[model samples]
Target: MEIPNDSPVNPEQVTSAQERGNPADMAQSGDFNNSNSKKKKAGAEAGTSRGNKSFSIKLAPATNLWTTQKNGAVKLRMEETCCGGVSPLTVAQMFQETVNQCGDHVAIGFKQTNQWETLTFAEYYGECRKAAKSFLKLGLERFHGVGILGFNSPEWLIANVGAVLAGGLAVGIYATNTPEACKYVAQHCEANILVVENAHQLKKILEIQNQLPHLKAIIQYKFALEVHQPNIYMWKAFMKIGEKIPDAKLDEIMDSQMANQCCTLIYTSGTTGIPKAVMLSQDNLTWTANTAGKMVDIKRAGRERVVSFLPMSHVAAQMMDIWIPMKFGAATYFADPDALKGSLVNTLKEVRPTAFLGVPRVWEKIEEKMKETSAESSTLKRKIAIWAKGIGLQAGYNNMYGNTSVPCGFALANSLVFKKVRVLLGLDNCTKYFTGAAPITKDTLEFFLSLGIPIFELYGMSESTGPHTVSQKNYFRITSCGKTMEGCKTKVDKPDELGTGEICFWGRNIFMGYLNMDEQTQEAIDKVGWLHSGDLGKFDEDDFLYITGRIKELIITAGGENIAPIPIEDSVKSKLPIISNAMLIGDKRKFLSMLLTLKCYTDDETGAPLDALAPASVVFCHKHECPATFVSEVLQKNDPLFQKAIQDGIDTVNRRATSNAQKVQKWIILEKDFSIIGGELGPTMKLRRGIVLKMYKDIIESLYVD
Candidate 1:
């Protein structure tokens, strides 16, 4: 799909910007030779070639959009080709195309008044346009921000698209962020408007309103306003503000949009330091959505459905829940605000979604819940399930190993057990199961596989527009992240003997750059224009990517041996079935140690870890002839039997360790499990290494003491 040649900016003017010695402009225009240092230019060419040699398509020329970075020095590094089969389109253009094709199809489903409420594609787009006009009437400026802090609701999406439609950047603030974090993002993005889901989120904004000088107004999309103030409006009242604004004015802004210009700001949930705003362009979102949808064979007939419950502030969630669905005209059902607490499965059953995505923690919870239910079955039923699972496991392995033949009795097993299991979990219709944003153990993968559900893993960061490599149907490995996308390129830079090195990416999916962070941007995208992912990984012979570790997370012992924590932690967990979390310590100490948290019951409403043991843990304890109910109870009593069992598991893990430095020499069990509320995990349930270290500093010091 060729872009029209009727661009308003003259090619001559863009050439002038490159000649003005602006480094960013030179990078975008592919004028590497014009650099002062010839060595730098040569390296850039070599790096570019190494990154894009696998792809054959010719890239479209950079347009005026490439030079339109008003707030920062961030610029897109020109690639040899656009994302394989996608045209460079703005968010508004993409939405319109879907609306034209599926006007009457259901676009969104939300629960209201104890019933599912529906919005057609045409109606969804119409509401967005109305919201856009209101944004203009409320003084949203070009290149400024419109911060939306809330759950995944129709209003959140509408406000997001509306901000872009009105020529402003859409900034999604995490609903879990504190008032200070909200202020940092709002102030950094120069937000002109803030949209909250309800009074709870509104209260946060109100506390920091004085610090956000650029914020002009606030809109509460849910619940009636209990406190009235100037420039604060309810959802209906806010939508009416732009009634006097002309459609032609909004249309002009839409027409002026370029795919390469920034439209969204995704702030990273940093493990340490302040969050940096990741500047994503219109092309980045649209190209990734189109190419990724094609990679996974997403249907465009409006027959696809998905459930949105993950935090929209995350790149993966936004791409899967909002961008991809919008691209394919799929209906998205908004799960309850407390969906992660326990309600997501109910929505999944009601929606019968065709595709589903979850973080590793979410999938792990599902696995545990299924195991709990299975334990209650009668002897005859248990025998039948065991028999069926054997066939399912073989069939699952057959597919993973590229064996097309189905195992004998597979059909019978599916009819008897797998089908029933899927129905019980509300996933009878789900064809794709995705897990990402954190490492998932092989045990969990196999557990789901035994139930005839294969969870494909995706690998990427916020900088890559969610996924750079995707494991999909007919192209997946059990423990490896699959091949790079069609139009993208991945380079394992400076590989050692094992071929593991930093995973670098080059493609249209790369972000424009961090908003207003020139130094950090330069550190990320090198002179060769490849975005350094900071991840350590190597590809197999089949080009399947295996993530070994991250540069920042690698532990270096006193003996100078480097070790990756994930593999060791995974090993410990696999050996100890009762362990919920295991963190490897001893980065600069004499020997490695670990911090372990036992599996325990969690609050169904708040998701906090309760004192009682989980069902699986309870069963494990009973089998060992040591009955324990709470984690605190075991620690308080210092149960010798339980301690021996845990030590036995650690010894088993040590037997598999490669060297003395890699083995855990000491260990301690935490009183509670790691969780989002405990401040040990991020919003997506990813481990926060820095936070964990600070919180348990004394415990760690004690382990190292003589």
Candidate 2:
């Protein structure tokens, strides 16, 4: 079925039966219509001054309307029930409330010295109090930013909350960032104090410390006692420094914090250029945590457990692992950094968290592992697995389309195969498994759904407090990022003929703006408070949003035909298991071309060879094993058989293209795959198109030379 891309269903268009006694119905039935018209008229009259103010043609209620303003901007105000009840003003208040309610409950858990360690809410709060006092003693002032560079740990969370309690801002530095990148963030935020996890992070700071005159001290969380340097305080000694100050002093600092004040500076992952510091206020954090929790129906008071492993510098990690847990008294287990590469599967099995948030790559790896494991079973077992999966897919589809009843043989299939798969994936107890940070292929989404695991795909950026829209339980679309959250407004600005346009937003969760970058900030948020997201997207009749591509990344051919490369790239990669990455090229050329990278056969960490094979070969072999010669020959770029496999994959993907312009006309398979260390991919695995284009300019030109 071809998906329709338009604004959400209008309240006026809704059937009477669906709208009966609904708030949306009440909004559309009265003077509200006239008021809306008047507002549009007023906006139109002042359109000249407003500049391109075009009011939306549909006039419905606030709950179901996408109202057009005089400035020609379309706006959809979400329903109010989406918003959560009264939330605390600041992180300090949230901490105090959680401590009072669940002081003895485990707040943070981690593995240390081959055994698990934990800290209770009361213990964590007490640590924060001491840290806040220490910061005060170190001359930290209101709104002064403190930089934390490390992996996820109890100390990282404590220092972050402590900074806020001390009336200061907490700035997280990505652990994978280069030393120069680290210096830029610390200098840009003017961090007064910097905290490092160990000598590795501390060394990065020391290399550039001379350039940071504002940095007064450096604290090491781990291996603190072994280090000796001027102005370098150990974690234990740092907390002791705060003990010298009276408890009343720390309380006074916490009391002075305001809801609207900025509490943290989260830098954007620098995929395109230098990272920009996003200032999220106390209100933004609390509101998002409370509101998103309600929308997803997350259990509170230590009932919910989640694995914390994603980079804390990312907003999603902060929102899920820190804010949501603190707000709802959910226990969070910090996954060990060392075990992340080799022991994640065992960790997930052991923890069996109720909620899991993973990027698309993580899910892809899990899916691959499942395939490998299942392939090792007997022929009969494999057939049963396949048969069970088909049944599960039908059940999942029924649920997605709002059919509550299960298929006749679904229970048997579940008990026989699906249940074991779920157990193996460590999702037996999981209620919510979310995938975000980048676009997930439809193939990946459906594969999990077929196993009775609904992996919800959400949409948001650092500017929107992590996620403003998410696919709800049993209410979702195949490729959509779901509907707007409560108290949030979204619109497609000046949509094209196909109804695709830049997605704009307005909500309390919108950021305070980039720190010390006023001109750029003004360019993002307009005078009326709407944040102009650079990404192009479309909305269906059901209000489900489908992100197409970035506005700047759109390719306009010489024939004047516009193309979105993401869907095409995703389609190509999904069809070819042997192809690791694909990038479309034809911005100002006659036709489309592609630059593809092949998959690696060796394990990234262990240096062991894997049984990676092309889809065609996999189907023929039936067994998981590939011939030794096949693996060796495929690694060579000039191998004819390997080239044939790549060409066949491209042909399959081209068959699905809606238009001739979307098909790849020419292509070249690169000798290497993109990696974060190579600067071709970002931390979240998003392609740095500009960088890739620049790096492969010669190769790209070669395809068009003919």
Candidate 3:
């Protein structure tokens, strides 16, 4: 109700509606215009229809819908989901034909230090077909499934396209996935060929190779620099086989690629449980990318040059790295292996990418940079910077999406101060700053938004083809996750008096269900067809959906009151200057608590510890005095940011609930952030809440103890 308030009504005085809104709106029949008997029949039908679906949209207020964002992004409104229409050229054709059209243009690349190994459209297509032919020579069938386990690189993407081009389904197992997890998917997919990156990756796959009956071929793209391995087929040797196929017939083979066939299987990181393989069809993927492209306008995409560092192993990265550029004929440049400071600066200066999509971690670093550099600056200077940020936001909105509400003086403010602010963050080249993979802290997103940097926070999962909803460039809000994609029917299943529930998605992009887990698939998608997202959400007066948290993850306490953890955690993280991520813990306990992580900052030169201005807009300590510690140290600082953040977290809970479900009573901070290597987080870097709870079981229990 405050700081980007959605509800016009005060949070304290809102009242709940009585009748659970009608689940269906049946057109009344002839004989009786809603008489008792007909009403009974109507009610029955409504109940049947609503059996799996949520409350009917006809009853919900409409203001909760998308209007606009400061991102300068335009919304392409569509009356229908463009399924079965222009029937997009399949992924393989899209890439090849684009390369054919833009032959000599540097189409894509992977980085090595300051240099880049480039591939023009022509070169890219040539490599794709040759690899495809070679894959066929290795005994790939029209229906064969090819699996890949690797880190992000051009090779990973090339092999994926080759599989699709050769009429094989590309199933990507998480490189971070365990041996048992890999075996399960490989066996279930019945993949015959496996393409892995290096010996270490291959070793993981080889551990369960004997258990996999269908796996017949294993090709390693990079040889282990350390030692020789005879069983693995070297990448260079494999390329030679690709020459065996006649070049004259390449086009003919690629044209036969079908759109409806399962093109890929990207398993979820399994933060919740066993990773479910999402069967992504070409039509589904093509549809999603095209839809998103229209919204972002990546075709006339201003920021044509992209520095892609996100994991290609994930769908979002694949969509951005492979699909977006192919659709727009844009040049995509890869950043160094490390998406951190040094490589980031080099890539930005060298490639000067026009557009960029970063997760919260990356953007937060930029925010941290602003605070660090301006540490000793006067209050007016910082406030002026904040004001200028608002101007930049206005200009960005006008430039990108064309809503253009900020008037002459506001416009003047942008030209004088905000424009330079954007360049400093290295976001001047960025046209659309996409925020996804996890919930972006609204405070952080707002800061970027105010600064004329466009940030789009979206919602989706591996099973939903990466995104079901995203904040439209022209129409967006800090609280809402934009409107649903054209055809998606999003609903809140159950509601307290407030009308929120388990989110259900039914759309063209919903995967062909989980791979091989037929029973689990059936359970996920009901008979009538609705992919249960498992996340809880509610739409506002504008029809924009605001997700709270996962239903299964919602902890019910001893008092039988259900508490959602994410909202509180998000508020806490957003308000803190140094806190990175937090996990909420209450479950069977009386009060909610949290496990926090502190972010380590670095000086501009060495990337070492540096001072960060607290939210008070005052610098607390210089490089020497900055303390690095856990929860105990944070409390000792007594800075305004810490107090504000902790208070905000509790206040958010109190404002949203009954007193029993208020802010957490206690919390602790861990020595480090959740990361993939430590297994506290997944490869995509989303925290595994369950895993954290287990790992810190004793630490979590202490708060409840006397």
Best by lDDT: 1
Tens-digit lDDT track for model 2 on 389-437?
8888888888888998888889999999877776776667788989777
- State which candidate, 1 or 2, has the greater TM-score: 1
Q: For model 2, where is the 10-residue window of minimal lDDT?
A: 64-73
- Give the C-alpha lDDT of model 1: 0.78
Estimate every model's Cα lDDT from 0 to 1: 0.78, 0.71, 0.61
* lDDT for 332 (candidate 1): 83
Per-residue lDDT tens digits for candidate 3, residues 1-706, read 0111221111122211111111122111001012234443432332222123221111111221111111111111113546324444567655544554565556665543223445555555555665687787777776567888876666676788888888777877766566777787788677878888776877877789899887767777754323344434655556557566665455455556555546777766443455566777665677677776666657542227677777676787778787777766777766665665445755565555666777666677777777787777888878777677766656655754456566456766667566667555555555666766655566777677676676777777777777788675676777577778766668888776787888888665677656656677777776666678888888888778898777566665433234566666776776554566789887655567888766644355633333332333222222224453433455466556555555665566555432343467787766555666567877787778878889999999998785
Pick by lDDT: 2 or 3, better one: 2
Model 3 stretches astray by more than 4 angstroms: 1-84, 223-231, 247-257, 300-303, 340-342, 376-383, 390-403, 407-417, 494-497, 554-706
Best by TM-score: 1
Comparing 1 and 3 on lDDT, the stronger one? 1
Per-residue lDDT for 1-706 in model 1, tens only? Answer: 1111222111222222112332344222212122333433332232222222221222234532222254432334445555553556778778777766666567777664444556566656766777899999999999999999989888888899889989899999988677877888999999999999888989999999999999999988877676689989887778778877877788778877877778899887543235678888887898899988888878885768888998898898899988998999887888998897898887777777889998876887798787788799888888889998888889999998889888889999899999988887778878999887767778888888988999998988888999999988789988888889889999999999999999999888888777777777788888767889888999999999998877777675543344678888988999899999999997656678999999998898888999999887888777776767888877887877878888999999887653455689899999999999989999999999989999999999999887
Model 3's lDDT to the true fold?
Answer: 0.61
| Error in Å for residue 406 of model 1 | 1.5
Lowest lDDT block of 10, candidate 3: 25-34
TM-score of 2: 0.70
